[model samples]
Target: MQPRRLALANQKGGAGKTATTLGLASAIAARGGDVLVVDIDQQGNATKGTGIVATEDLVTTADLMSRAETGALERAIIPTPWDGVDLVPSDISLGNIESDGSNDLVFRLDMAFEGVDLSAYDAVLFDCPPSLGKVLFSALIAADGVIAVTEPTIDSVEGVQNLITTLEGVRRRPNPRLVLDKIVIGRRRNTGEHIAREAELRNAYGDTVARTMIPELAARQDAHSERKKIHDFRGGRAVALQVAYDDLLDELNLTSSRVQEKGA
Candidate 1:
């Protein structure tokens, strides 16, 4: 059984896409399930957050995207400090891939995983760049589902709608199997604006929006800075974040048994 591959995507920067990806990975691992995180963002935020400092000689997502080769992704997979989690890291050089003129560039990421078995893990997550570019398209082609992560700001609805348009395009052509699995509201606050936006989103999307909303808490940033998982970080309301991510994991049905049954 192949693991369910999902892309965590939102076109707007600072929308907490990377944070959600890492948080979910931590949650899955803490539940005794394995997860592989593919960091396609040039910023390498996910890589750094997982306690990895990629030096120059390491194989990265850039290498996987540069060409269409079978089993290349296996080489890029490296162990992270977190248990039951592996990573395909990225760096600033990945930015150059957007400019390449190759007509097959968007399909390379899918090709890179050919002949590689991913059944050992519960899920594979693609941490996409905060843009609707070639990299994002590639991830969509490779993934089975997408989790749209967004904030409760005024413009967040527009951002999610735009990503939905992109997903429609991908489904029409490149990946018919790709599905928009859920819309996760992240970095939420108790302010009136946030409350209104959240209500608007639920009204617009209805049950497509996830029931679990991740709150904006200082412990998230603090854990990222300390290179620790939210479940492992103790102090300053970290327990809230841990509970949120755990709820999200269950809400998304990302547990090993559920994912495997889906794959089967």
Candidate 2:
């Protein structure tokens, strides 16, 4: 079977989309499942968080999207410091797609994966940019599923609604098979507003909202700063972050059979 491809997206900044992308990748890697994180965001936070800084000569997601090369997909995959996880790193150059104005621009990302075997990875995560632009549209067209990452706030909730609308439009034409897999509540805090917003999301999304919420923890940032996975980090509630992600993986059905057998 093909690997599950997911686009972790939120147009609103500070929604923890990048963090969640790496966190889930770390979780899957810790379980001995391979993961490929495709960083399509111009900020390249996901690329840097995984200790990758794509140089000018390197083939990145931008190279993959620019043209339909024979081995472009293979060239873009780079192994990171984390075991069992690879990356298709992106940089500022990815922003050029917005202005390219090619009729086929939106389909280029999907074309990049064509005829390429991706069964090596258990999951492929795309960290989309914070906008409803061509980049995000291309990712939606390319991915099999979308995971909306958001904080429990008014703006974040609204952002999820907007993304859902955009996703619905994409499904109608570009990608009829695309599914909104889940709405993840990230960087959750124990405040009245947060609690109320969480309730609002669950009420609106029902079981589509993930039961596991990523709590506000400093260890996340600490691990990212060190360019290490949360499981590899040694300080400041790292265990808590790991546990939260484990629960989140369970909710997404990403834990491999080997990991479950080992745990059992």
TM-score of 1: 0.96
lDDT of 2: 0.90
lDDT tens per residue, model 1, 146-212:
9999999977668999999999999999799999999999999999999999999999989989999
- Once fitted onto the true fold, the runs of candidate 2 whose alpha carbons sit more than 4 angstroms away are 257-264
Return the top candidate by lDDT.
1
Span of 10 residues, lowest total lDDT, candidate 1: 255-264
Deviation (Å) of 85 in candidate 1: 0.9
C-alpha TM-scores of all predictions: 0.96, 0.96
Clashes of 1: 0
